[model samples]
Target: MEKSTHEPTADEKYEVSSSLEKGTNADNGDTRFIKSPEERKLVKKINWVFMPLVIMILFVQFIDKSTLTVSALFGIYEDTGITHDEFGWLGSLFYIGYLAIQLPNQYLLQRVPISKYLGVILMIWGVTLGCHALGRNFAELAGLRFLLGFWEGCTYPAIFLLISTLYRRSEQVIWFGTMFATNAAAICIGSIIAYGIGHMDGHLNIRAWKWAMIIFGIVTFFLGFPFYLFLADKPKSRWFRLTPEEEKIVDERTRDNAVVQNREIKRDHILEALKEPRLYCFFFCSLFLNLQNGAISTFASQIINRMGFSSLTSVILNIPYGASIVLFVAIATVLSHRFQEIGIIAIISCILPLLGAILLLVLPLGPVQLLGLYLSTTSPAYTLLQTYISSNVGGYTKKIFYTSANIVAFCLGNFVGPIMMVGHTAPRYTPAMIGFIVADFLTALMFLYVRWSQNKENNRRKHLEEKGLISPPPPNRELLDLTDKEDLSYRYRL
Candidate 1:
């Protein structure tokens, strides 16, 4: 394929300058930093500082979310005196608000500058979580958790925007996968915090579980500012202590990556995004994948409790689950980079969870069986699916929509997962496993549909070109090869 030296038309260049002057509150300077090909390649490589910031924020976010699960060992469940089913509701309610905020959050990322917007969100969630220390009933706790979800929803889409803007399609899966391993770290760290605090139930005449929430909230609040100061709003807006060359490299590399197909966000383009079929199919797949994700987030602690271990040991033993997830993510990232076959990687990941659920349902209750459940449930499907979304959806508007839709699926799954842990199924958790099995099969089917549809589109393009109905396909780095652009018959991952 001919290399794209596709500079914007004069009108487009003028529009970008006009936007910079009006939006950034600065006189127009040399704002648009283009680069030579060598500089562009160097910059396109990852920025070390930003990658760590992304990992840190993601780690903190996951720890805060998963810490509640670890709290089960400290008598939080008993203090609340909620039924098994109600416990599920308490767990799932966060996502109800989480889903509600997805679209608004994505919109804000596009409109409000990221530094102010994302930093404010982090502080809001941190303070709201601290309010949990005062919760006296299920209703009060639920409200705080919901608000936390609402404020925290901004982070996911924003992170997606940052990474999608920084890294190219091939580099994303590794960083995304590594960032995802924070889920495992969160689980391990949450358990460690809970284990230490679980002993303080009578020390301060307060419940250990309440202490768990209080401690984590304070830490998250403190970490927010440093993270905010360090995060790059976008490659073009980066203002850290980097040398001029580093800045130039980042700007050039990020632009060449298919990610920045359009810099100007418009209302008409936003509406046009809603029409892509890939957006919808990916939504369903994400929903099912996240259902399992949400279920595990809510109940993995309880599942471990059945393994004849103390809450502390249950928490500690569960470290392997997260560790396994880290391993799976790393493996998947390598495969995606080497083979570029998102479909096969996704299929294998989904199957692991399906097998894990089956083992939980049929095998005798024992350590081995329980280990299987943990291994299967914690597979890397969720992050890999997200990689597929980021890699394929190139249009800025469509990326926003897809990102929001994925979070919505996450919310739905989180909402449904806990509810399935019926009161009758407590300890046995038979019903929850059954729900997981069904969700896994549906997720697999969606991936299959995504693969088949993309292949069909590719064939159609080939046929049309053979008949001289359309231009011949270029060598693989064309927009068609990148597969992220709209209007290219690039099928969305179901």
Candidate 2:
């Protein structure tokens, strides 16, 4: 298939209509959607300006949320004299706040413009992060953590909406992969930042961890001020960059704002979203995948410390996971784009960590065990799986529903993940590892099932066409039109 460098043109109604059953198919072997050289140059410019700004915003959000996990290793538990069990409460408390306001967050993302709403949300979370310096006890820490969660919940749903609006289905996979990979960078950078500043424990008579938290928080808070100036709410809204030709193509490809418009959530919209089987499959599968991911993210520093590595060494060791994530995300994104087969890559990603989980559960604490833990952290398969879903699912209401459900499941999974680390399972952490292994296996099975169900649905639709019960023509040639219609060429591929 030839890739189009520009969107449909005004006089070229053929480009827009060709994907429908009633029109000629542009994607037939004899025809291709290749753009003119001038059009390709314009697309390159727009993508360059926008992709980095979006990725940077996501990176800061992850760094702020994840720093606490690393801080637990050298700062809080070391200085405040808290036990590991008490530390678990601190780690898991954020999720309580996360789940409390997911639906509200989605509403804000949908109703308010991204320029104002998301900018406000980012500033609030940054302030919450800075306030960690005020928490002197468990109760204070828990309260602050909840507030942080409340603000942080806005990031993912807002990003989903931005992505659904900004990019075509084929282009969103890499951007989402980059977004998730930033968390791995947080895992690495947070530890290094913590290790460097941790020695400031008695500086000005404040705890080192508290200072680390306050500094990063203040930095993130101030960073939001700039995003307000640079980030475009949608492709049509780009004020500083983009040629008129580039804007026209993007507008047409995205249906000229009709498909990407900000919408108000309604009761029936929620009900309509709840009826899809793919929604449940995505929720349950992602729930398990992130359960394991949360475990790795929240407790990795502690696990490294317990393996007899010094604080500096522990931080240094974390670099591998972050490095691996960068490589894997790039590889996965390219493979998904080239093959147009996200499901196969997703399945392979799930299996890697499952093996790693088993190794962590059964092996003795040593270099081999540490390697297992590091390898376990490299799964971006679920990241790709989710990108596929987010980029493909049509209609604003259903997209929001699936996005919110995914976040809710993520919070729920993280909540349960820490609880599994009961007092008896501490230190060695045999049960927590075993639990992750089970979650991985189940997630893998569900992904396979969804893939099978999608194939079956496609086959059934084809059979109906033969019997004249369904339309004879396929709309795959006109992918843009597929975004709005509920029938004919529209079908969720899970």
Candidate 3:
């Protein structure tokens, strides 16, 4: 049989109608839709499927990555013949491998099935984490750490992409916050696990720290199969069963997100993204914010140890640090959702850390200094930054590029963070604290600039609409897959 040459009809080419949908208001002609009871139920179902999987995957990744710090307390350094300075290199090298592969990973994400890609990487890294148990020196452990970082590099971007593809822009902040908050929770869980494992000293002739790596690694390895089976790449994936109406709702939601679902890379989209000033702004903000994270996450236990606490006591002290992180993340996300103003909420988040930095710099090593350290868990602000990028950026390729650039900056900050705390600095790493304070202040300023730029664009569009210079956008404009700069009708949320 000869192949038929069939062209798509206009209706088929654009599945959405030009008229506003049922939930949206036609009078104001806004694209925003209030969810109906049916839509709410559908969202709930999606949450049930996605939330636990993401939380578990991310939690394990955090726990596995954090094992280095816990192990440091449990005598991985002494047992493995590694010095404190060499240990910093281990932390920094992970990000080096993480940074190196991101551009290629972005391309792979564009071409591959996301769930399968993530699944394979998860399993590889799981084995890599377990290998840490066998390393007896710096070179051996550092090599495994690099491989672990390289494999784990794609995990966060994949999760961010999944959340963006699944949820509306307005709903993304809460979900992002929820997933990232796992990092804080992981600190406590890791500490408790380490404390338990510490009691296993001399069992089976293996060290407690080594056993920590082995146990978490095995658990992570087994998780990969189930994750691959359960995660849906998009709403249309075989993992989900949707009625016709529900499928239509998913399509409508995609349109409302103002991002392309198409996988094809567009050169114009990349060029446009390169020209965007906001892209660079977000990049620097990510870099500076994570510098603090690099320092704190790797050295929190050691700092407590320096304050005259025993190894076990130091591990327990991190519980308060973890609690503070959960509190800050919860508050920031809720306030951002309530006010619909991430910029301001991000500023508040930064301010707390800035105060924490000041306290750390001035106060002596005691309960007060510890209080400052706990207050410095501004990592939640990083979650807000991720939400900002996913919700504001448009076009598939541009979004990918934006996220890749942000990750590069994130890796750079993490790579440099540990290096700032020299061994001689010890408990009073005054210079590092100073760097934290400065970075936090600059991040706040960057958020302000983003908010200002968005307001300027919104006002210009409003004026043009009033003067009849530009017509309101068609309801199907989002289906066109235009970049944010190309889509004049798209107003950025603060």
What are the models' TM-scores? 0.83, 0.87, 0.93
**Lowest lDDT 10-residue stretch of candidate 2:** 24-33
Which structure is stronger by lDDT: 1 or 2?
Answer: 2
Better of 1 and 2 by TM-score: 2
Number of backbone-clashing residue pairs for each candidate, in the order shown: 4, 1, 0
Report lDDT per candidate. Answer: 0.68, 0.69, 0.83
lDDT, candidate 2, 1-494, per-residue tens: 98879965654743443242343222111112355554466556656766676777777877777777767755676666667677777767788788888988777777777777766777888889988877777778879988888888777777877776776665677778878777777667766777777777779988777887888888877777767776777666755366555655665456422245546554555676687676787888777876777777777776777788887687778888777777777787788766655667777777778888888877887666776777675348667766756755666666777788988988887777766666667556787888788888777777777777766665665567568886633523333322323544444333
Task: Name model 3 segments beyond 4 Å from true.
Answer: 1-32, 474-476
Whole-model lDDT for model 2 versus the true structure? 0.69
Give the per-residue lDDT of model 3 (tens digit) for 1-494.
99889986645533433234454222222356567565677788888877788898899998988888878888788898998888888888889989878988988888888878888888988999998999999999999989988988988888888888889888999999998788889988878888899888779999988999899999999889978778878866665677666677777778767775677889998898888888888999899988888888888888888777898889989888887898889999999887677788888788888898898888977766787888877677888998889888888888888888989999999988888887888777889889989999999999989878887887787678779987666777757888777877766878
**Steric clash pairs (candidate 2):** 19-478
Candidate 1 per-residue C-alpha lDDT over 1-494 given as tens digits, one digit per residue, 9 for 90 to 100? 89999988644543443332222101111122334444444444445657666777777788777756776677766777666666677778888878778867766777777877777677777788778878766888788878878887778788877777777555677767777776676666666667778778767888887787778788878777866676767665545444555554444344334455344555655566576566677777777777667777777777877867777777777677777777777887788666656777888888878888788777777576765656575347777778877866656766777788888877887788778777776665777777777878888778777777666665665466458786433433322313244344233332
Clashes of 3: 0
Q: How many clashes (backbone atoms < 3 Å, residues ≥3 apart in a chain or on different chains) does model 2 have?
A: 1
Which candidate model has the greater lDDT, 2 or 3? 3
Give the best candidate by TM-score. 3
